[model samples]
Structures are given as C-alpha cells and as structure tokens.
Target: MSTGAFSDTGLFVCFEGGEGGGKSTQSRLLQQWLEADGHEVVLTFEPGDTEVGKRIRQIVLSPETGELSNRTEVLLYAADKAEHVDTVVLPALRAGRVVITDRYVDSALAYQGAGRTEAVAEVEAVNRWATRDLRPHLTVVLDLAPQAGLGRFEERDRIEGESLEFHQRVREAFLAMAAADPDHYLVVDARGSIEEIHAVIRARVAAMLVTA
Candidate 1:
C-alpha cells in the first residue's frame, strides 16, 4: 500500500507505446488501482478530452487527413498540448491530484519527432514552450516489436490508421527516448498477457507511490 507522499504538487504519469502496446488498458488499470487505494486520480490523454483536443484528435487519427507535413502535425499536436496542460493537467497537479496522462510530449518527440525526422533540438524547443517543461514524475514505455504491435492493431482493424512503416518509426523513437532518460522512464515488455503486464505496471507504480 502506497502511503501517498508524492509531492505537495501533483504527480504526473504518462504511458507511451506504439499502437496495440496496451497503453490505454494499463493506464486505466493503474488509475483504478490507485483510486482503490484512496488516492485522488485524474486520467487523461494527449489530444485530450477537451474541445480543441477532440478536434485535433480527429485530424491526427484520420487517415484521410493525408500525408500531413511533419512540422505541421507537430505544431498541431503542440497546440493541443498547450491547451491540455493549462486547462487540465496543471490544475489537477495544483490541487494535488495524481494526473495520469495517456500520452505526453514524449509521444510528440517519438512520433512526430522521429517519424517527421524533426530535429530533436527543434522538437525540444517547441515542447518546452508548449509544456513549460512540466515533466512527468514517471513515464511508462511499453516495449514491443513494431511488426508485432502493428499486426495486433491491424488484426483489430484499428491501426490508429497509421501505416506499418509509420508505426515502425514511432517504435524506434520511443526506444530512443527511453535510452536517453532511463531513471524516470520504465520500458516494460508488452508481449505478456494483459494481466501479467499490468502486474508489472502495478508493482512499479505502487513502489513509486510508497516511496513518493
């Protein structure tokens, strides 16, 4: 049981992974477990649930949006993020609630950052201004092979409508992010059964909560 001493400020947790890596499932599981333990929890996503976020969500997820230029997509994502941070995340943190975001700037750095071949420095610059460097206390990256993950998504006919090659690039980008920041990030195997995977995640978050 976590004693719940994270910070006077809210603790932000984000999960990143390619499609079918179980990010959504694990995020919900973590939130439920935390709340069950008597903690305040706010679960949100990038291209969030807000009005602007929903609009951008359609653009990003729609295959018909066509080949959006890298910089253009990144800028749109950043714009959504700025509003998301200001209106949702920051307030939750200020109120000392645990904010569990489905994705964050790292996703931008990995997807648009890598897929677009946007210079890391440029990506970082945009993200800094957008998020004001509001780093997450913990970021969980579910690691799985690009082909396997993509296959799962395709099998479900829910590829997030991304092409196979695009998903591959996104996977590589996430791995790079994990290498650069190992301490705050945990790269977990996503090949296991959902229960097994969530078990590792639960243990990891619970430990953080206890020591937080």
Candidate 2:
C-alpha cells in the first residue's frame, strides 16, 4: 500500500478507465483546480510520459505493430511504468507536488487481464514490481458502459479495436478493483455531464487535500 519514499510526501492521484472514458479531460480539470488552489501539480500520463515511454506507447498502440503476444504487451506496459515512476512520478511527489496521471497500473491490470486474457494477479504482480509498489492515494474511475464509451471515439487504437466483449470485461475488471478498495477509489458515472463529473471530482479531491 505504501511506496517507501512517497509514503509521506505529496499526494498521488490517478484517473483510470477504458478508452474514451474522459480520463484526460478529468485529469486536466483536476490539475487545473489543484494548481489554482495553490498546490504544485504535475500532470502526466502513462505509456508516453518520457522518451522511452513514447517509443513503448507507439509499439503498444500502433496498429501497424500488429499482433503482439499478451506477454509482450504487458511487459512493454510495465517497462513504461518502471521508467515513468522513477523519472516523472517519484521526482514530482518528492518535491511535494500533487501528481495527477491519466492512467496507471490499474490500466494494465484491467486491460491485459480482461482484453488480452492474461491473469489479473500476474499482471498486477508485474506492475507492482515495475512501479516499486507505488499506488495512487486516490484513483478516480470514470465509469461508463463500454458501448457508450467507445462510441465517443472516432478512431480506435489497437487496444480500442478490441471486441465489445473484451471492453465489457475490462469495465467489469475496473469496477471490481474499485469495489475491493472503496477508500482509495472514486467511481464516477461517465454518463453525467462534464461539469457534473468535474464537480464531484473536485469535491472529493478537496476533501483529500484537507486531510493531507
């Protein structure tokens, strides 16, 4: 539950959901709100936050990369996490900056476990090692039906092009993870208006800041 060095420093918040779940928008809104409230905020994302990550992101998401084995896909994702935590996340948290990310380990656990048919526990173990067991103080899940969420995207990435059944499984995986750890996760209905969702996120984060 604790990642040693980051245990007592700045808060780490992550937004997680399937594709087109509005994680990017909500993450940006949270970052803006935190900064306006006089908090030092670092906004970043997985699979593309660093030079190495950029390449990994391309390899993982590019349709041209073609059919990667489940093991290869998960390892690439873990590699990105290892570099991301060491460079972007840890440094920001150590500096007492509120670190908000678009996605995190949960993405791998959900996507690979469900979509790629990998074992959830195995994927989680890999990610835990990659991230040195660092976890978000708060994980906001923008929950939406897979069909509804995918409809929002005009073009699909390699992962996004998965079957409806695959996406449904991923959604369930996220919900199950959040249900198991209610205190650390806020599961929001992505069907709501953007402002409504942001208001709820702001309120939850505000409460967290007060306690922090």
Per-candidate count of clashing residue pairs (backbone under 3 Å)? 1, 0
Looking at model 1, residue 203 earns an lDDT score of 85
State the lDDT at 204 in candidate 1.
78
Task: Give per-residue CA lDDT, model 1, range 159-207, as digits (tens).
Answer: 3566667778888888887887786788999998889988987887888
Best by lDDT: 2
Per-candidate RMSD, Å: 4.6, 1.6
The collision pairs in model 1 are: 5-212
Q: How far is candidate 1 from the true structure (C-alpha RMSD, Å)?
A: 4.6
Best by TM-score: 2
